[model samples]
Target: MSIAKTLAALVVVAALAGAGITAPPTATAAEASPPRAQAGEEVFYHVFFRSFRDSDGDRIGDLRGLTERLDYLEDLGITSILLTPLQPSPFYHNYFPTDFETIEPKYGTLDDYFAFVRGAHARGLKVYLDQEIQYVGEGHPWWTRSQGFAGAPFADFLLWRDAARTEAEPFLDRATWPHYDGRQIGIAMIDLNNPRVRDYFTRVLLFWADPHGDGSGRDGVDGYRIDHMMDDLDHKGVATDLFAGFWRPVFEALRARRPDFRILAEQADWGFGEDWLVRGDADLVFAFPLRGALIDLDKDKIVQAVRETEAITQADKGQIVFLENHDTDRFMSLIDDDPARARAAAALSLLLRGEPLLYYGQELGMRGITREDGMSDSNHIPLREAMRWSAELDAPGAAIWYRGDKPWWTEPANRAHDGVSVEEQQGDADSLLAWYRTLLALRQARPELRGGDQRLPCGDASEVLCVLRESGDARSLLLVNLGDAEARPALDATIADDRWIDLIDGGTVDPSTLSLAPMTVRILGTP
Candidate 1:
C-alpha cells in the first residue's frame, strides 16, 4: 500500500477508537450532555501562595488565601489553577523540595492543601501542582545519610563534585554554591538511575494523587508543570534518551488513571529549536520565544524568533505565550515602564495563537527587576504588589489589581496615570486594563484567533511584519510594525479585495495603505 493510504488508514482507526466504535461496531446511544471544553478554551491563574495577603499580615500565602480567590478566578472564567509547589521546601519559590509528599508548613497543612483542592474542584476548577524535581538542596535527607543514597546505581542520581580530578572537567564549587541561604541547602539530588529513586518518586506522586494508596485514594492531580527541565539530570540530555526512558513511564501511569492529565515543562530554551513540546514529555511547553520577541529591543530579531518558533512546533502544539511570568523581570519594566507598550504587548498576546499567561500585576503595569544583591530574596522581586482598594485615594478600586504600597523594587509614583490599579481601568473603555479585557473577549469570540491557519503577508519592505490568520469561517490580519516609523504597505496590488475586511478601522479593505506606528500592532478581521 502507498504511504499516504497507510497513514489515512491509521487515522481512521484512531478516530474510530476515539469514537468508541469498535471493530465489531458496537455503538452506545449518545447521552445528552454539554461538550467538554476544547483545548485552549480554559484560562489559568498563576498564583504566588506566599505573596497573597488578607486582613492579617502573616507574610505567608496559605491554602485559605488560594481558596478565597477561587471565586474571583471562576468569575474571570479561569478553569484551572496552576499552583506553584505546595511541597515542603526551604526556599520561597519552592524549587528546593525537601519532602515531596507533605505540604509546606509555611503555606498550609496537608488538610489545608486538600481543602483548597476540594474547593477548586467544587467550583469546577482543575488543580495542577508545579513539580520542581530537577535539583534538590544538598541537605536532603537522602544525601546526608549513607544508606539514604544507597539504593540506586552509581548513575541514577546527581552528585555535587567537591573538587575536580582533572583540569578539563566540570565541577560544582561545594563551598560557595548549593546554598540558598547560610543554611546547608540540604537538598540532596536524587539519583534517578537507582531503581530505588524511581520507586520513591513514584510513591511520592501516588501518595498525593493515588486515592487508593490509603485504602481509597480520592483523586489524583489533574496536571503538573515540571520545572528546570533544561538542567541535565541523571546524565539524560535535554533532547535525548533520558526523558524517553525515565520520565515517560511516570507520565504514562498518571495518564492511565486520568486521561485528561496535562503536563507543562519549564524548559525555557526548548521552544528555541527542540521538538519536546509534542515529543511525549509534556502536553505544553512555555513559549519563551514569544516572551523574548515581545520584550527584546532588537526589532528584526524579534520577528525572526517568532517566525522560527512557529515553523518548528506542530499545529496542535500546546504552548503558553506570555509577556511576563513569575521569575522574569516584569514586562512593564522591560518596556521602559511604558504602559502603552505594555498594553500593546498584552493585546498582541491575546490575539495571537496559543495559551497566554498574564503575571499577576501585568494588567496594572507593575514595574520591578532583580536587584544586584547576594541575598536570593533581595534579587527576586515580588510581582504581586498590594491591592489598592480605596477610591478616595483617587485610585480605581475595581479597575485592575495594583500594588498599593511600593514593592521591594522601583514602583510607579502616579498610580492614577500609569494604570497601576485595577479599579481605575475597570470602567474606562480607553484604559489599558479595558483593552486587555476586550482583547481576551475577542479571543473567546473568534475561534480563528484561538487556533487558526496563520500566514505572514508579504510586505513591500523588509522591515515590515505582516501576518494573516484564517480558520473556517473566521479570518484576521495582524500587521505589526517593529521599526520606528509609520509603515505604509501598498495593499491595493497585494491582496484579493473581496476576501478580506478590516475590523479595527470600520471594515477597511486590503490593498490600501497599512499604517503601522512604531512598535505598534494592528488587527484586521473580515466583516
Candidate 2:
C-alpha cells in the first residue's frame, strides 16, 4: 500500500477503536482504553533497534521486525516508543549519521519505516525518533566535501580548528576514528552557529515530524529525543550558548508546526538538567541524578535526589525516569541480579511523579556491563546485546547481531537457559517480567500514579523510601524497602483515613502498621 493510503486506513481504524467500535482483534486490553491525552502520563519504552528483534534471517533487527512486535509493547502497557537513531551510519549504534535524510539500509527502506509508524499508531502508541544532528560521520556528504576544499559547497557546515580548514575540532577526544568498515574517518561536529547548518537540520527534523507533509502525522514520528544535547557544543568555545540561540529556535519551529510535539533532551553534562528544561525549551530530560541514586540503592541518596529534582523541575515539565539506557550498564547487572531489588526499582520508576522509560529487555532482567577492551565502537557490544526472546539465544525473533563477532556474548548474563527470556518468564507469576507487568498495569489504572504530586513520607526510616502520590481526591502511597532487612517505616498520621487498600495484592491494611520485606514494594491507598 502507498504511504498515504496506509496512513488513512490507520486513522480510520484508530477512530473506530477510540469509539469502542470495530476494534482490531489483535489489540490487547491496554489498547482498548483511550489514549493518554497528556505527554506526562505516557510510559515510554526505549528501543535499540539493532538488538530488539529480527524478522528476516539476516540476524539484524529491522523496522518490519519491530512492526511485527507491536502487540508485545501494547501488552506491556507502553504508550510510546523512543527509538535510537535510524539514519544511515558506519557505526553499530548509529549515533553519528552519514546521512540525515535516509533510513539505514540494513534496517529497511522508507516504506518499511512508514509501516512501523502506522502500525504503532493503530495500537495507540506514539513513536519518537532519536536525532544526533550535532555531528556527522566522515562519509557524510557535508564532511566528505569539506575535507580538503577551501571553498567547498558545505565548507562552513563543520567546525574547523585551523585556518586552512584541514582539521576538524574534536568533541569527545579525537576527531578521527576507524569506521565499522575498517576505514579511518573524521567525526566532524556540526557548526550550530552557522545559519545555513541550523536551517538544514531544522528541515531534517521537520521532514521526520511529518514525512508525507499532509500534516496528519499518521505516518510520521510524534516527537524527537535530542541525543547528547549540549549548550556550548563540547565546550570548544565555538557554537556557545546553544540552548538560547540554536536549540530554542529549532524547538520553536517544531512546536509551531505541531503544537503537542514533545522534545526529550539528553543533557551532555548529565546534571539535574534544569537549565536544559528551562533555557533549551525541552519538555523532558533524563533523570541522571535519580538514576544514580536508584542504582546505588541508598535510601538517603534517593530521597535527597528526589527532593532536589522536585525543587528545580517545573510542574509542567517532566523527567524521563529510568534505570538503564543504551549507554549505561543494565540494571540487573548493577544490582547483582537481585530479583527483589529489581522489583522495587520497577515500582519506584512507574509510581514516581514523572513519565517512566523502560529500556528494551529491561523487563526480562537482562544483564550487561560496559567492556574495558578498548575505545572502539565494539567496546559497547556487551551493553547493547540482543534482546532475549527465547531460551535459545539464536531463536527466530532474537536479533543476535553480534553473536560470534564479540567475545562478550559468552558472559553469564547472555548465557542460554538463564531464565531471562520472555518465553521463560511468560507463565511464571513470581518472575521479574511479571513484576514489571503488574506495576505497569497499576500505573495505567491509577491516575494518581501517572501525574500526581510526590511526597516523601518515610520519616527517619533509613532503609525505606516512601512516596505519597496525590491527584486531588485520588491518593496512593508507594513504600519500597531498599535495604536487605525488613523495614517498618513510620508514616505520617494524616496519610490515611480509616482503612487503606493494597493496590497490588488487593487487601485492606492500616498505614501506621505497615511493614515491608527486604527489597519489596507495597502500594497502599484508601479503600
| Local accuracy by lDDT, each model | 0.56, 0.81
Q: Who wins the lDDT comparison?
A: 2
Return model 2's CA RMSD, one decimal.
5.9
**Clashing residue pairs for model 2:** none
**Candidate 2 at 299: error in angstroms?**
1.1
Off by over 4 Å in 2: 1-37, 178-184
Cα lDDT, model 2, residue 435: 84
After the best TM-score superposition of candidate 1, give how far the Cα of residue 212 lies from its true spot, in angstroms.
Answer: 6.2
Best by TM-score: 2
Q: Give the TM-score of candidate 1.
A: 0.76
Could you give candidate 2's per-residue lDDT for residues 294-349 as a string of tens digits?
A: 88878888888988988889977889999999999999999898887888888887
* Regions of model 1 farther than 4 Å from truth: 1-37, 40-43, 53-56, 75-79, 121-124, 144-184, 206-220, 234-241, 268-275, 278-280, 297-299, 375-377, 382-419, 460-464, 489-496, 499-514
